[model samples]
Target: FEALHAAVAGLPVSGSRVLPGLVLRRDFAAYCPASGELAAVVVTESLHPALSAPGVEFVVGSEGQYQASLRWCTRRTEAVMKRLQSSNVKLLLSSVKQQEVVIYYAKLYGVSVVECLSSEEIALICEITGVSPCTPFGDNGEITETAVATFCQPLLLGSKRYVHVGFTSVCAFQPHCLILCGPVDGVNEQHAAALQGAFTMLQQLFKTVDQ
Candidate 1:
């Protein structure tokens, strides 16, 4: 990570704004899609397992399941939501249900939620916005001031328009780079091909150097 930081810093920039380091927080967790069970309970400085026991499982069609789910969700979400609600920066999730109960709570808290993003997209958004993506229901290390100057506007090429969004935070998995390109005209393949070629070349160069 330090070497990558040095390399990025060594790159020449045409403007006066120092290129922010592609530095991710040391506390970021590893990606584990199947680890949902591991996060069923969120322990924080203020919230801990000692405060409550796991709820008893009830049979289907009974209110037990709903009550348990809601209790778990609220306890888990509240831990992080309270911290984020007071923050001035925007929040982006890789994917979230518009009708999810969490969304309703998030709205109530005045949190701005951008959903349906992929992990890569979230990382890209972080790079452009300089906001770290925090783990849901987990500790948010330190909320830094938003990098207002780092915002990027949508790129329009002919008929296709591309938007960049990110999820950057102290708990992001790692720093990443992403470039999204699509045809403005539904039939235009040339632009997409060119962009893909450039991306591939860049990847190959990086891999070669790493080797």
Candidate 2:
């Protein structure tokens, strides 16, 4: 709570409550989604531009966080179900939902949801791996891997072509995993090596328990 409060103070923006968009880092139990599943959800307009893709569909919602799209993602479990229901909808990468919310709704809807690393956690991963989050405030790490992968991977993979405004959250499984999002091609070898080293060190740290 103190960390979040401090991060918020650093931001020029002000709000009574911490918005999901403002979240840079968080920690919680991991949730598991069923294998080979596709999900969708309502995202904030702030996020829609960066997130908009071919397979994923979007509809305007009151708030960027919880809206109709999330509902659709939850209710429409199978691609087959979505197809049978609507010809226009297409599934891209699965939607990233909060772990706690996913667990509660998964049981209620009988649809499985996956646990994702928090935005700050992803930032730490990049730092540990030697890759910079590359934002003015270094707060980009506050986003989710799902968001990061969607926006950043294209830049890394050479599809998106231009940098978009606002932070796109992304995550990775490796301890020192570094995901760079930008029109810039190929992670420079130096950064890549650092990421490799960081990941190695992190792995060793975790291995302590196993030992």
Model 1 CA deviation exceeding 4 Å by range: 1-69, 95-99, 127-132, 139-186, 198-211
- Per-candidate local distance difference test: 0.38, 0.31
lDDT per residue as tens, model 1, 1-211 = 1211211122223211212323221111111122111111111122212224458544457688768766775676665556655554333233323335455555655444444444554444455445554444335444443433223223332333333222233444444432222323332244345556786899899999999
Residue-by-residue lDDT tens digits, candidate 2, 120-210: 5444434333444322112431222122221111111222121111123343322212233322223343444555677689889999978
Error of 1 at 136 (Å): 3.0
Give residue 7's lDDT in candidate 1 (0 to 100): 15
Give candidate 1's whole-model lDDT.
Answer: 0.38
Kindly provide the TM-score of model 2 when superposed on the true structure, using C-alpha atoms.
0.23
Question: Residue pairs in steric clash, candidate 1?
Answer: 125-165, 125-166, 126-166, 131-168, 132-168, 132-169, 133-168, 133-169, 159-184, 160-184
* Candidate 2 Cα outliers beyond 4 Å, as residue runs: 1-90, 93-187
